[model samples]
Target: MSDTDDLVEIEQLLARYAVSMTRGDVDRVLAVFTPDGAYSAFGDTYPLDEFPALISAAPKGLFLVGTPVIELAEDGATAAGTQPLCFVEHAQHGMRIGYYNDTYVRTPDGWRLRTRAMTFIRRSGDHDSGRPHAFTRS
Candidate 1:
């Protein structure tokens, strides 16, 4: 396939991931990742097999994922991208903002995530968060 096709497929993969998580579909979520995929968040990394537990521990939320900025590899066998994320919690009506760093690998089955990690961009009044603002003059 061409580079455009690869990019589109990766984009689709990311969309599927968000949808699956929002729907609490474990199997669908796993399908986007490679067999040995690893997801890192909350200061811990969970292997592919532990994803179900991770999913279970996840809070119910609406995941609003932004379009990823993807870059293809020279050989087109791998790719990487970063996508912004916004999650609105159901119980507390709270919100969390973050971005996902994902590495993609082309498998015989299609494009799948090799690794996925999240970095949160905390806002003011957020619990356990540090200064979440731009520098200001005193």
Candidate 2:
């Protein structure tokens, strides 16, 4: 595929992830990542296998993801991207605004995230309630 094609695919991949995660579809969310993928947030990084629980543990919300800025690697096998995120709470009157830093790999199944880290910029209401899952960007 051409670089444009790759960029489109990666953009769609990011959309897929946001939609799936907002819908709380664990399987679909997992599909956007490599089998050995890892997600970092809440001051911890969870392996692919642990992602489901991490998903379940979060409050239900709608993920409003901004357009991603992606940079393809010279090797053509990897890429990096970042996007703004707004997680509006559905289960409660709360919200968490953040951004995602992602590392993508060209798997046989297509572009998948190898690593995804969330950096929270703000939180409020039930979202800021005594849940110890908040973390900062490094």
Q: List, residue by residue over 7-106, the lDDT tens digit for candidate 2.
A: 9999999999999998889999999999999998877888998888778867888999999999999999999999888889996858778789999999
In candidate 1, residue 55 scores what lDDT?
A: 80
Backbone clash pairs for candidate 2 read none
Write one digit per residue (lDDT tens) for candidate 1, span 25-86. Answer: 99999999999999877666778998887788668888899999998999879999999999
Off by over 4 Å in 1: 124-138
Q: Residue-pair clashes per candidate, as listed?
A: 0, 0
The CA lDDT of each predicted structure is 0.84, 0.85
Best by lDDT: 2
